[model samples]
Target: MSAFSRFTPLVSVLPSTVPFVGPEAIERQRGLKVEARIGANENGFGPAPSVLAAMREQAGDIWKYNDPENFDLREALAAHLGVTAANIAIGGGIDELLGQIVRMVIEPKMPVVTSLGGYPTFNFHVAGFGGRLVTVPYVNDREDLSGLLDAVKRESAPLVYFANPDNPMGSWWDADRIVAFARALPETCLLVLDEAYSETGPAGSLPPIEALIGLPNVVRTRTFSKAYGLAGARVGYAISTPGTALAFDKIRNHFGMNRLATAAALAALKDQAYLAEVVGNIHAARERIASIARANQLSPLPSATNFVAIDAGRDGTHARSIVDGLMQHGVFIRMPGVAPLNRCVRVSVGPERDMARFEEALPEVLRLLD
Candidate 1:
């Protein structure tokens, strides 16, 4: 039997791939249950009691489709940030929103700028849309704002993507520096400021909502998937000018928002006390991770996000060994995918028991490598 042959040329030309090989797939492939799930940057701390309650109550209503407009969640987010509801657009997650943003602006062969080793999901979206990605290498383990700006100008790129409290390396820039970089970009360029790790970052690290709220060219994407402990809920939002946000409606799935996920997010927002408590726990877990790395004689990079990127003192192969070796013991962790950055393995902050498992597994994994 042969497959249908009427697919678009771009679709036909693209190779099939999964950017992330999830733990579930690993379990299926290796026949090993994931005893400690501390790899996916998921909040191992779990969601708030309030969010759980809300989801449970809404479970009965799952038979109905979610509101196409996502009015309630957007209003709740607006009140939380003191922005108007029109400025918000909801999506399945940052990953889904990324595709929408690319579709809204990218044409085949148009330029899109990003850090070389930045989030891969964004790059995947660019590829799907046939956008030419112009990448700038990270400098000293941080995304080079100057280099990104240069590429944007050089490529005359219509869109650029950046993440604060970045993934893979868990490095970040202070708000003032980030604001300066955003302000310097040309008004014609659209900036996708991914702040998925915002809840775990320090106070001065995030600029005030009002800081970039006025810029028509800037759209900040945030997720409840981080400190809110809601990754499975698939809830995220974009903050932009009302005009800029309306563009999402043009290409978004009218019923994409899950009713329960919106309910979970609304309840999550109301539980600020829970958020503050989780942030504290995240900080403590980060310290615990750092201490464990020190005891193992490896260096753990400081992280504002929910994960630590530990320098394994070697190249990508060595880092891959540590990663694969951990999975052997049912401890699933990840590492950066590119060179230089791949020298570090990223372990997400999790419950004390999971961390204890990681602590127990590290020495044996390194010993086996020796």
Candidate 2:
């Protein structure tokens, strides 16, 4: 019954936690089936038929390992983004790349800067590496760029994480401001510009590849999980100077990528028309979610991602009650974690069936709360 005593100190002291409790875990813990899974910011509209077909075709090759170089995916992404293949590094997803970045730059007790309530998975990676997190609170529901830069300077932090079309709040700054923020950071600091929701964001919200590609300290991460509807496939990549991008190869899992996932991502990239159509559907669903919130007398904040955050007009407890109540009726959703932000509930865009289930369940949940 005795536990192994040889675990690292950091691992022993860290609390066992997940960035988000998945819907499957919720269903198991609460003994309820999820009728509508609009909580995880997944593209419930699903992947393009072409992507599915490609995956099916490649499934027969599952016994083979994916190319360690990730040649085809990186080359495809480079051509799509107008960059050289040497400027790219592929990973299982943004989450894995974040962990690698943290390990590359952080030593024990070193400072890492990020928004107070930004993507929790980045925070989790920082903690796993024993880095001290220096958080800057959101200003007006958006990640405070000036505040984050100030903290980075004040702490002389070597690593910083920022997300465009940020999670939890679903807020973003235009490309110009993001570029300025990146330029302002000291050359000693490495910036992790997380653009996982890039395809869903508005025009001019993403900086062009030419803007920061030459900066050695800047690494922009993107994923197939959102607009591409490939969350299950676990494909993502980082864009940086060729020198900086190569750093991931020194520490990354050489054969971590799945073969079929690579095929799906390649097919998804080739089908720009499908991406556009899904984006249009996503826009409509955002409006539908906002309308549902307004009909229930709650306010929906403007969102640049696949999800919308609705202000429940009270404290964390009240927002939590609505989240819980909705789940009781088989509609699964989530809420922000920290104070002030926690007054809102976050819902992801899905198909009309999921939206209809949410529309029917929300008013009943709120009525019960009333």
Q: Judging by lDDT against the true structure, name the best candidate.
A: 2
RMSD of 1: 0.8
Instruction: Write the residue-wise lDDT of candidate 2 on 1-370 in tens digits.
Output: 5778989999989898998899999999999999999999899999999999998888999999999999988899999999999999999899999999999999999999998888899999999999999999998899999999999999999999999989989889999999999999999999999999998888999998899998999999999999999999899899999999989999999999999999999999999999999999999999999999999899999999999999999999999999999999899899999988999999999999999999999999898888
Error of 1 at 243 (Å): 0.6
RMSD of candidates 1 onward, in order: 0.8, 0.8
Q: Candidate 2: which pairs clash?
A: none
lDDT per residue for candidate 1 within 1-370, as digits (tens), equals 5878998888888878778999999999999889899999999999999999999988999999999999888999999999999999999999999999999999999999999888999999999989998999999899999999999999999999999989988889999999998999999899999999998888799988899998999999999999999999999999999999999988899988889999999999999999999999999999999999999999999899999999999999999999999998899999998988999999999999999999999999999998
Compared with the true structure, model 1 gives a TM-score of 0.99
TM-score of each: 0.99, 0.99
Clashes of each: 0, 0
